[model samples]
Target: MTSTGAPPDWTTVDIAVPRRSDRLPGISMAGFRQRVPSPVDITMVAHPAVTLLIDLGEGDGIVYDTPGRHERGSVVIGLMPGELRAGGRVGDCLQIRLEPDVAAAALGASPELSGTIASFSDVWGRDAARVEDRLRAAASWDERFTIAADILGRRLDARSPVDPEVAHVWRQTLTSRGRARVDSLAGEVGWSRKRLWSRFGSQLGTSPKRAARLVRFDHAAHLLAAGHAAARVAAESGYVDQSHLHREVKAFTGLTPSAVAVAPWLAIDDIAWPASSPTRNPGTDSPRHRARELGAGGCHERQTAVRDHC
Candidate 1:
């Protein structure tokens, strides 16, 4: 993977995606094995999901800067995580993208994780090493996937789920690809605006408006990466104009729309999140198709004055 300026050459990367039956709701899994690797430094950009990377690497394979630095065997990347990267050497990693609702249960707490990056041990404690050991010891990538799925699935069942109303609002925001308005969602969900805001932030970790913007920006960023014009992306992704889109992009991630479109971090998204959407698959050609998958996670709705139409 190319970092420190030059874009990565995609041909050398080998990414393994799980079969449909192996998939878990609200989670995306991919086993990444990079060939012809080099020291890599690139922006992680901002996305709507909580990220968990289990280093299948022999040593510390990644380093995260800015947003509370920490390094270890595996890392937990909170929602809207800013720039970060894998180090100069290539290694194996089981990258899992957990939707906010699912993450609240699986990772222990959403408020504890939002906009932060830390070692998996910071949250999972010893379980981090135990799971990593099983993954590493497994004979095949598929077996590793199974191990991870079991752990996460167990956690999902173990912890209390988010409130039904809050979960509904989140699902609506995602289904609308961040275009859903807060007021509209609240009204639909029959909750007072203030109550909805309080519960959403407390349970999901980010305010409702912020979550939608992150999801919207994520959708737009992927579209831009797919070679769609910024103007076109803005119009279709629900922005008032290209400049509105530009501001949000720069706000969430320190990069302009053009740069984010070709971000090295997103270069491997297809292999990493193949089932992020229904039609998308690893190494696919359509950016538009992949963009759709970016917000494929679930949530419901309610209405409020705080809108994320930017």
Candidate 2:
């Protein structure tokens, strides 16, 4: 797939969108290489404003570190820090879902919940040690996720309920409009601008407008991956112009639209299609649709320069 060579002895199969569950709407699955015996370094990156993570797979654990060093294997159950970044090796890891509440909780005021999930060695308490032990003892990816979910569920349940109206407004603004006017969203949520900011800051670690932008970026990435043009995707995703789209794509993904389109790794052929959903197919574009497509040209040349230099 994608000319990566018969799949590495251990390959990661990631599914960006997952079927809805009673608790979470979306899921991301990461299938680790079974043959790799030692931890293989990997990175987990997210769009700005989204901070929660779910560990559905295997290996020692995930480590959240700063510029130079990092903590080793640790299972992070609650909200991740605002600047939390993941780096570690994955082995037999399955799936993880970042729930809204977990994300919100991490954004709330708490010393233990500030930034990324690090190893037990990085933290200072007995609780962290216990968690480390449990994670290491876990046998499978499912077991790890189960423990993580339980810990997060407890932490979330202890927090005060968020205003349903505000949450509703946010959901609507994100899913339908792809952007939110802070003043307008505040009005719909029956809160003052200050109050709305406080709520969003404490719950999302970012403002509503910022969160909306991240959501919009996610949608845009999907469209680009589906072979849509930059101009069309920009309009559909609520950007002002193709240049704006390009800027945002570069900032979030470190790649331009055309580069992402032509990258062998981003090709549809590189992924394993889930079989349960008959409605979903990776490369089922009609001949007519393919005919109207513009191949990645200029952007490809620029990306080639970056790759060659690296």
Best by lDDT: 1
lDDT of 1 by residue, 1-310 (tens): 1122322433244567665667898887877665555665455666678888888877556666754575755788888656655455557778888889888888776788887787888888777778888998987777777788888888888889888899899999999999898999999989999999999999888999999998887777777755678999899889999999999988877768887665544545633553332233244434322222322212111111110111
**TM-score versus the correct structure, for each prediction:** 0.85, 0.62
* lDDT (tens digit, per residue) of candidate 2 on 38-135: 34333233332223333334655555555554554443323323233444554433333343433444223322433344333333235655654564
Error of 2 at 113 (Å): 6.4
TM-score of candidate 2 on Cα atoms, chains taken together: 0.62
Model 1 TM-score relative to the real fold: 0.85
Off by over 4 Å in 2: 1-34, 37-44, 48-69, 75-88, 106-145, 262-281, 284-310
Residue 154 deviation, candidate 2, in Å? 2.9
For model 1, the stretches where C-alpha displacement exceeds 4 angstroms are 1-11, 274-310
Which ten residues in a row are the worst by lDDT in model 1? 300-309
